[model samples]
Target: MGQGQQEQVATSLAGAVSEEISASLAPVDAELERRYPGDPGTRQPVHTVYVPGDAFAADTIRSWGDQALAALDEHAPNAASFAAVLGLSDELAEPVHSRVRAKLEHEPIEDLRVDFEDGYGPRPDAEEDETAARAARLIAEAFKNGTAAPYMGIRMKCMESAVRDRGIRTLDIFLTGLMEAGPLPDGLVLTLPKVTYPEQVGAMVRLLEAFEKARGLEPGRIGFEIQIETSQSILATDGTATVARMIQAAEGRATGLHYGTFDYSACLGVSAAYQASDHPAADHAKAIMQVAAAGTGVRVSDGSTNVLPVGPTAKVHDAWRLHYGLTRRALARAYYQGWDMHPRHIPTRYAAVFAFYREGFAQAAARLARYANRTGGDVMDEPATAKALSGYLLRGLDCGALDIAEVARLSGLTRADLESFATPRRGDLTASGK
Candidate 1:
């Protein structure tokens, strides 16, 4: 009787109802697609080295590499000694130490920014114009000769009333110089510092638009990083999240949001002693930035540590310990990139980065392999987790923290396969993967 009486239960809403709902929400869907396009699936550098515009030269990259190696030779001459200073495990000592040295020799600075802001200070108008033009010419030569950092650019002055026109003039001179030198280098970057309002981001977009038009380049071709220096950059007077608005105002031209440790801390009235990237104030600002940039194809970068690795061996070691610990902490928190101020800081920066990836290499690769192969393990992983794992391995490879052959052997996946997994599909942005 039950079998005869049961009715088919597959009939409910008509097919047109589903279509109608989708039609009604079409604009919302478009907004979602436009606003949250996820990671761009490109190589993000491990650290940005800021050299004053006046100090930057054709041989600056090699000079930094040499200085880093000399520091290593003097302070921690051997792998064992260097490992002891940074408290590396016995297994990681040799590999990490050797990799650090090799990285210094081969590719010391991943991203180099010639500072025209705080680091460069105020220069006479004619002097700055000449320097900006010279910077562009030298950078062009470096790239042509294959001696340039993988990424190179300038950090122009802020949008504040005091320096707005000056910043615009410098950026114009720099980009114009590059255009005259040749088609701009593909690795070119620009930074806008001390953004206090989203309107400033709009201003930057307009500025870039003008440059592109004048140079007969495609629209929206130039992108820049928005530096979060003042407290107003994080929160508005009305308590709204200004950073989120800034990203929207960028109109797809924002490549990154970089924290400015000292300026931000000082803006909040934090004493000089407590001004650091890890300070509570800095954490709050960066956390907001991380959220704001999560699915918007914009990366977040931590600021530099003021502690330089200099002086006697003992003092150098102390500075190394501090820098290493801070770098490791940032990596753990998923802030994959930071600023490296000095050539000597390069050693500890690479050491910490290598050790972080190397220590977790096995687990990440295994999890990714299992997820890729659809074989269950004690820890189950979803597609997003697979993306994260592949991304981790890729970053390791990019920064010399892990090698492709070893990663392939361990994960049973090729570089192409990892790239497929690491690249995000539209409408998903659960992890930064940078």
Candidate 2:
């Protein structure tokens, strides 16, 4: 072939390839555009603490915190080590004792999901109602007593018809009993577990709306989290990813999608020994969740480590160590939240999270400040980089890893500058003198 003819053919082939790519990805782009509300990324708790419905009480968390602190003291060498483990400065050594006390006494429960499913399990129908009502009463007492966490909710049974009636009944009874004490607490959510179809989420939204109206609350006053448990929820029979579709079915009310460790792993046929948050199937599900729910602002949480760090007969430092290792793995995967099945896990949870934020804070703060000041640094600061740094700082602030004064001292930027960068915007992020 002639050289000119060959060049023309190559150009035509490139154009065709581009068209094919765009055509194949049109649905993905469209799905992204219309994703439902996920975690706002404004502030998310590091873990969702679940207690059985029949057993939950406001002071239960304080007891857990107390136990956690006691466990740490019983295990950790000294005050310095404790402070160091939590990424606290020397000054904090004195106050962190009281701080830890206050945290336990006040808001130790970050995300509380009173479980009616596996945690509560299938019980006598009356027993289920009684447990649900008891949970409602305790949570309501917490609300009036000002002991509730920032995020509190209930996890109902799967809406798979077999238990759908029972799930809805439990929710209804809980809400009714809760309102009798006072108005609903802030950041309340309903967790619908074992989702298999998009329509189930839509139905839950409608149910919440009706509950609001019946209670004389505003529309959209309630929100929900979908537990990603079954294979069907992740991959539709239609041969497309369906998690986004499930969130969409929420109609702007899905706050997060939580991975159910055992059920999800079981669905994938992972043996009991291999089923874990770090498993490949679990990671794939989370990756799909991240893509479908990223820009949509939905929070993605990894599944729990079934292994608790505590031993019935011993200190079980090795158990705690293994738990910490797994926690670090989850953090490395950018999943800041997981499940703390036991009080001892709480200490390990904060330890891992503190290490993550502290190790990166110096570099992140410098890069972020330099980016904000339009000054060149060792690293080029792009918009996404700025946002990530801002998020890192915000998360640190939320989780108590970094305080305002500490942030100011480290980042060399004002709180206002931090907030400004935190909200994402589209633009060229050219470093000055780059």
Candidate 3:
């Protein structure tokens, strides 16, 4: 083509591109106006809670109740004490309920888990005729009397073959009965144990779907909390992929991932002499779960700190509590909520959560503030500066150390500035003190 013809074509192409860019900017401007009109500088705080589900038991209903009350009075004074209780059948429920009530009279509590059954393996033949019926009756009674705790929940058995052989059937019957008896409780978290693969999760999802349909409940009303107990679930050679697959398979059905530190350590042949929660095996297992759950909204919880001291002596017990605090903090830093198996451990639980967030957020804010001061331009140009600023923002957001707006304000940046720094060619920040 002649030079004149080629130049004309290039000019037309550039005009078309400009028009496309203009069209795209129009909606972006409108969205900015709708979401942040005259409020470009406004920042919002990120509210995040590190949920520690109860792995602790008071030994008896009375003691459990008393301890729960005392703990609430002590550590979670403003917050309600939450408990997860277990019962094999309806006959067992009343006895358990009566015990919990006596303790709560002194101290208020929130949350309860009426375990449908205990232990693993096939459900007993008696389970069908008696256990299921009795559990349903007791739950109905609890509902009618309004004596049941405010935050009530039910823990269905895990998805082992033995459970499928019996417990699954029992669960079907029990869930149906519970639905008919009253409104489904505040929430339902299927406690799946020994879940080795995605197919297993898929199985649970299917079952939950069917139950919801039968009960005329929302299709995804129920959620799951998977227990990463077995070595096979974490080790690649032993079907670790299955665990990752299972999580993906459950998709919207999963709420959280919990590490079974003791069980995982045992599966790895770690000596009984070692502390399960602190063992290297346990760390690796938790790291695996953390990596798997990277972008998934599902929360991850660490296993309980099983050591229970006789009494609270800050001098003697301080080391124990600190160690526990550090472990919980590490998990929290890794973005996993941890479990507190005993009430005395609550102090450590809250302490770790507070320290991790406070320290992390402050440090990130300081660093981002420094970067902001160092760079004056609306668009950052230095490679190292841009990378550090971008990384600090992302890590802060991931750990709940800083929200997007806070990151922007502290870094003297806009959302577009941070996003541009996140582009592949720019890369992540370099390690400090290297």
Candidate 4:
């Protein structure tokens, strides 16, 4: 067709019809944009390491790294031994093993949460207040000194009637200390645990708003994770999904929905022996949470395991296998993040993540390269698939599972290029028909 003919063929609908349709759907479009803005396109940590409030010290992060390395040294002792325990393929054994050790030695704790909740139990009001303030100061200093995790904050007590006032006071003290120390760190993260109702979420929103007003900061500057520990948080008594309501009630301050393994399991009366992240009840709850949080800029995190890797070499190896398998399963399901309770869990966590990303890195990079260049291959690609591919590579890079140089070498795309594809606007995705 001639250029003029092609120009004339643009958009079959009449101008007036198009305008009317757009005008009629304006509200719907606005709502869609408001509710589903896709991911926030930030770096999501692979795991959150929870340290008890009183136990968290200036050197806590480094201690965890050292302990993780010690665990590896005493148990696996070498790359081959570690790989054999996790059944890593020969191709991945060396790279994955070396990477895991390096990660442990360097960025061992991506996300650190000083737990003022179950981990702290019930401390006296004065003691709790002091501890919270101390935690704030330490976290602020750590971030300022460049020793903080990529994300660091506290998991405050739940909003239940019994602990509501205390939780509020503790959060206030912590935030106040942070402000006093310095402007809150960009990596600061807060978690509201055991959220059983949407109103609880609203309360958190109000609290953050008040803090912002008091601190003279911008409105909506604070966001917190809602810990889903109760069955009611997943399925309301009235037959609605309470977790969904919780997200809406946050008024965009909810950053995550973290499943609470033991608490959630016990809430449903699941036997202790049967309680696990892969349990049917746990999976059901997380599935609902995932659907509800999809495209809302809120991430979902799986809960932790109670099994600690502290025993004979054989027993530790068994625990490592269990943790590694669970991590792999969660990765395959696209969860990407979970909880690591003990320092010992770090090795397996990194191993599973590294393997998961490295095993498929070549294919994902090649596919994305093809999609970006519009080179047809054995498999036809769509924009959504391209988005997923880019996002996968981005996540791998974020958590140290994949390096930028290697990624660029294989994908022929820079980090910035990957980000562009990973975080395209909804309109952009539709307009760029691959």
Candidate 5:
């Protein structure tokens, strides 16, 4: 062929490729529109917190089971909702259930999460696969028994096989068994730990799509929560664009983002000597995640405080309790949904959540009410004033410190007006509420 003919062929191929790329992206764009019709970035307030019971350590698991149940019993009156973590081990399954039943004798249990790793990282050996399968079976059986806990989920291993090898396979087998045995659990949360990039999450989303298809389930049925434990994930050089990509890749399958405090601190060489939870550095990381997840409908949660003393003391315990409360409040103010690693942490969890929301709601209501009364349509004449008032109301709503109705009422504005100004602001409110 002549040079001109060859060049023409190359141009034609390039155009074809471009057309194919556009065709492929069209559905993703349409689906995104369908999933997020109003504002693709507006974050819905996350009111509930899911506490992982650290199912890997037997002693910790048992203790958490007891503490969780006790907390539920003592605080159920004030508790909005609760979730328990169960390790997927045949050996531990019975004990976990027995404890769960015992603890829930007084109060109702709503959710159970089976942690695939028993805590010593993932077991890559073939023998361990058998053991894992057995554990998965046991958990399925327990869920089939129709206990009070309606929500069943699993925290599958992360991408790192050394840390949790049974990542995809375990989920493949467990979900198959659960579906085959009976109805699908109320919800399935695939917790991805040690996530460094959005592509890691996107990969899971693709696998989940395949799994859902193979299992004859609807696409996007399974929900995912990314553990933002690495410094890279939280503080990307591109301003959390990577995190945004990962959330977007989840394609609406992503539900929440969790902070992995100890792991993250370890990654950053932050000393373990000091509690990772509530460390200023950890707070900074959480803030970054909160910003990344803004307007994404994904809830963010802080990592757990690991400083709980084994034994109880009146004053010492109270001090520890206060510390936990402060940590939870900090996370709550950031608009994250869940925390991890301990059940005894529930008291402070509830305290911080209630205090944060209650105070936030009250303040927001007052401010919005004032804004509504003071700024009528007359304010709309001044673009600068309108923007300023809209900005104030939107920030309060975004932080979960205020509600949409209040924002609407205060600004004499519609919900659309408030939502239009929903952009995350830095230093508007400190995590510590100072």
Candidate 6:
């Protein structure tokens, strides 16, 4: 072919490929929208703290938060230096300091995940099943007594070949036991890890549907977050991205996409010594996840910084530095949520999050207001910008770094406006896990 003809042919092929993908997606897209009709909105938790299912207790997070604060006092150089690192003003520092003490005395855990996967490990099948049942009972009891964490869920092992049936059985036992105790608690969901095929997601949705039918619960009641841990999870057999396909397979039950740091890095052939949250491979996966889930209302969370803040023998400073840096990077990339592996990370998580939200908030809020009013000539306030700006403050409000009153004043938005921008939160921290 001539040069121009060759170029035209290449363009035709590209357009054909795009058209094929779109046509294949059309039905799934339509179904997803009809099932999840009005805006999917946002449900961004700053962090997910995973604990072994067998060890779960309603008050465990608060205990861990308290312990973290005590360690700070017994090991740190001075209160001021710690305050500086947390970016706490003297006034803010006092409250954070007191909040830690109070959180320990009260509710410490914000978002907790009971893990039957790596965190819990593979025990005897019967023993694991029993533990799942027991955890379910504990969670239901806490809900009945109005003591459950605001956001709580279970992380089962991968639903893929090797452990598929085991994961399903554990999930079935847990949900069955929990529902038997009482009504499903608000904000309960499942976390499906290492999803390498769309069929795995479809199977999970079908399983949840069965649970609802058996328990007389609503369909789509048990939503889930799909963990993108392997390269194959992102790459479909047809040479297209599968994030959308997995969410589509959920049939309106997929709530978020969570990246698995170490596993994803390993999948990319990274050595154990170099695998971290910000590894190139991990970031690439997260970026794809973010793009795939954007506008779909499927929240995207960066994986945890595995380096726990276990101390006395370890410098908390090093842990804090790593956590803070990773957090800031995630926040900057518009990924508001992440995972926390240690209780000592509670303070650092909040500190990093609050600092992120507080920074550029004033300027962003002002710009948002001007854009809405059509006074900021250079600023074109689009849906994405509005979501980002509002999310930043909503996170602050959730963390108590910014209150409704402050948000209204700074953003020129009303109480209802701010409230409407985000999901219903279990109120602010009370028992300070300082």
Top model by TM-score, which number? 4
Which segments of model 6 are wrong by more than 4 Å? 1-39, 76-79, 84-107, 312-314, 377-380, 419-434
- Tens-place lDDT per residue, model 6, 1-434, is 66666443334366789889999999987765565343355445678889998788767766777777776676553547666655566755654555445554565667788999988887999899888998888888877887777788799988868888999999999888877887788868689998988898999998988989988887778999999998998877788888878877887788889998888888889999889988888877888887777656678888888787775534677777788888888888888888888877777777666666665567867876775576765766554455556666766777655567766787789755755543322121112232
lDDT over C-alpha atoms for residue 402 of model 2: 68
**TM-score of each predicted structure versus truth:** 0.96, 0.85, 0.58, 0.97, 0.61, 0.83
After aligning candidate 5 to the native by TM-score, how far in Å is the CA of 33 from where it should be?
4.1
lDDT of 3 at 376: 45
Q: TM-score for model 3?
A: 0.58
Question: Model 5, range 364-402, lDDT digits (tens) per residue?
Answer: 444544544554432222333333445445544554334
**Tens-digit lDDT track of model 2 for 23-99:** 99999866654662223556788899888887887578788888887877777646576655444567545444444
Q: Give the distance in Å from residue 315's predicted Cα in candidate 5 to where it truly belongs.
A: 6.8
RMSD of 1: 3.2
Give the whole-model CA lDDT for all candidates, comma-separated: 0.92, 0.79, 0.52, 0.93, 0.55, 0.76
Write model 4 residue lDDT over 1-434, tens digit each, in one string: 76666444457767899899999999999998988889999999999999999999999999999999999999998889998999998899999989999998889999999999989999999999899989998998998889999999999988999998999999999999999998888998999998888999999998899999989999999999999999999999899999999999999888999999999999999999999999999999999999999989999999888899998998999999999999999988888899999999999999999999999989999999998898989998877788899999999999888999999998899999998998887987777565
Q: What lDDT tens digits, residue by residue, belong to model 3 across residues 1-434?
A: 76667443334365689889989899986654333222111121111111212221222223444664565454334322221111113433333333333334532223344454343223456744355555555555555766443433444556676566465766676676677788766533456666776677888888889888877898888877777888677665654555566666885677667777677777788877785666778777777787776445455666665576335443325534554455545644554355544545533343333334434544554554555467443453454655544644654454333457765555666656665554424112323322
In candidate 5, residue 271 scores what lDDT? Answer: 79
lDDT of 4 at 333: 85
C-alpha lDDT (0 to 100) for residue 418 of candidate 3: 60
Expressed as tens digits, the lDDT of each residue in 316-383 for candidate 1 is: 99999999999999999889999999999999999999999999988999889888888889996776
Model 4 residue pairs with clashes: none
**Over 4 Å off, model 2:** 1-41, 77-106, 312-315, 426-434
- For residue 59, model 6's alpha carbon misses the true position, in angstroms, by 2.9
Ten-residue segment with the worst summed lDDT in candidate 2? Answer: 425-434
* Candidate 6 least-lDDT 10 residues: 425-434
